[model samples]
Target: MSEDHQPETGEDETVIESYVAGCPIDPELAGQIVRLADLPWNDRDVTDSAMRGLGWSDDEVPTDEARFVTAAGHVVYGDYCLYLPFAHSYDVGGELWPDDFWGSLPGWSSQRGAGREEFEAHVDASIDRFAERLGPPECDVRTEGRHLAIGRYSWRYAAWRRGGNILVIGPALDGFSYAQDEEAVVYIGEFAKDSPFPDAADFLNLMHT
Candidate 1:
């Protein structure tokens, strides 16, 4: 799909676009996911049971939001999510570090037990780990920008598909803004028919076997 599928004008679309980029799924399906994710699920223990099966103790489970283990082994958090399948080599540096959730990285700051060199090394290791699961590198490392930004191209999930090499951008305000391509973001709304709890048991059992 080309990147031109996103709406170019409208108030609601503008607001939604900030959180959602290029969504290939049906509008109705996307709406369903968003609505389901927004629900409080206040009168139920739906999320609890799923987390327990996924090896999460009661303490690790979040009360306000939910976390899901993607088929590729990366963890995704939130209901209304923007899934970015990581496909490019990054060039992040001090300019992009120590801000928002990106600052949460272990060595983004000297106070976090790492200097600039150590932090860059940590990022290299992370890239290596991801590459091992995905494939070869296409671009070299770059370091320019106060905010972490991708280049003009990146592969994203086609639609409602799951698994594979991807970065799950949650309904988080701090960590995301716009993809370099603008249309590389896929809006994901995950929900269950019977309940809001994730079906971690089935996947957990599969993982064990």
Candidate 2:
């Protein structure tokens, strides 16, 4: 069920290499994560460029969990998705996330599609990288219950607040799904504000999430 669209090119791989100038990331993928996370639902042009520039491809037809994958068909890299806001919609950041379906929250996330050992190794590398890239985490982010399990939800994570962006990397995302064995992920998102209903910043976050 791949998309009609083909992946861009090696440019995306190039970018990852640049960012990986060897660090990994709670913020291990810091530069890329923040840039992708901050992109709202409506940001199609930038999102496309960003994803392609990061080696993502629509070739791996979107699934229930991801709109598009970072390394479309890469085996060892695991499955990663950098979800962006919809192009045509009236959603503007509001109503909070998961609890409100029509809310403007984006799930900028990734999970290791490899085996348990590979996944653990990847997560370990990221933690080690984050220690050097951005230091210790700010706090631990956890899901209260099934209510927070919207889209790809996170159950618990170590958080790092870099200005308006929050980098959360650890276990969860599938917070309460029946297929809950999958663990280890990274989520970068913006801090939500109490904006009035229908704010432009919403960017159709509802459908995307």
Candidate 3:
């Protein structure tokens, strides 16, 4: 079947572009992925269960939102790529990582802990791992405060370059809750000097894939 003739899922699951040489990701798409990453899941356990329901493989799922995938059938938003088996509490009527819940986690009293620090370090490691799995680029890790809080949950941000473009990855804010207990939510997006899509057809070509 030609790429243009494929069925439309209408679930915001269409691809926007193909792998182009030297082409960079669009800023609009990158912003959208960042918003998606900031989306809150009810809790970690619910997120895990959602992944299972989505039929994602075990390895594709992670205990934190610091992973990326490079496959044909994977989900794409602008320059961002999403792996399956992720959970979004937005579907279940729960806020992602509500602030009140952070107090419940052990060692989270002051927003600093071995666990929190470890989580941040893990995120750094994940970015490096993703670069190895995808490709190489300049890498940077940024944080706003001493603690990594997304919404109710704390998280860190990691950005890297591949070719002439930049890709950002991180966990969603308010992605954690006690009732649901979501571990993490991963998000990816790209930034480049020019739009990756040369024209409308180029964007559509990505959808066909």
Candidate 4:
């Protein structure tokens, strides 16, 4: 799936961890998964073990493409599914020092708008309005620019960095990063529940549960 693709729901409620840099899959893999799953369970076709090898448990076999795919522990986008375990990512060497990486970032966040158009609209309006109040941005991202294409964004203070936040806007699985100190992208904790960036955090909060 494209970076902007948001994650869909699953039965276990555990958001499949995909979209992280380095771990990439074919965007059409889900359709293939559905097709492979759709085939009649004849010996000539895919076997149960083969299905399991693709990350489907015995009961995970899809009876209905839409329902089963969404319910599987995999991150399900429009027509693609991500088997997170097989995902490969190449990390650029960067040292996030002193702070605990997980602690600095948000704990379990969601998206605001329902879909790309909806989410983009919300982001555009909110950021524009924020810029108006702040009186000219350090950098104008009034458009839903390419930055979000990576599925995550990091910002602080008036700009994208310290005291700022990071956003995961993938359609299959959305999340947030509160800040990045030095090398580590900080996860959200109790630190900035009340944001200083106008309605920035508040706006994104609507999409997340």
Residue 85's C-alpha lDDT in candidate 4?
Answer: 19
**Model 3 lDDT tens row, 22-86:** 11123333333333433223244544443444443345422445332222222222223342212
Q: Candidate 2: count the clashes.
A: 12
Candidate 2 deviant stretches above 4 angstroms: 1-31, 37-45, 62-65, 72-122, 140-156, 173-179, 192-209
Highest TM-score model number: 2
Across 70-183, the per-residue lDDT of candidate 2 in tens digits comes to 432321121233322211111111222111121112222222122334444555566555556667755544444333212333233455655544455554322322322333
Model 4: CA > 4 A from native:
1-114, 141-173, 176-209
Shift in Å, residue 24, candidate 1: 33
Q: After superposition, how far is residue 38 of candidate 2 from its true place, in Å?
A: 5.0
Rank the candidate models, highest lDDT first: 2, 3, 1, 4
Error at 19, model 2, angstroms: 30
Error at 143, model 2, angstroms: 9.0
RMSD of each candidate relative to the true structure: 17.4, 15.6, 19.1, 19.1
After superposing candidate 1, which stretches have Cα over 4 Å from the reference?
1-54, 57-63, 66-76, 80-113, 137-143, 147-165, 168-209
- Count backbone clashes in candidate 1: 1
Tell me the whole-model lDDT of each prediction, alpha carbons only: 0.29, 0.38, 0.33, 0.28
Candidate 1 Cα lDDT to native: 0.29
Q: Write the per-residue lDDT of candidate 1 for residues 1-209, one digit (tens) a residue.
A: 22232223542321311111111223333333333334333323554344344453333332234354322222334333323221112222233321222222222211222233432333344344434433443222231222334222212111122232122221111233333312112233333333322222222121112
Can you list the residue pairs that collide in candidate 1? 91-142
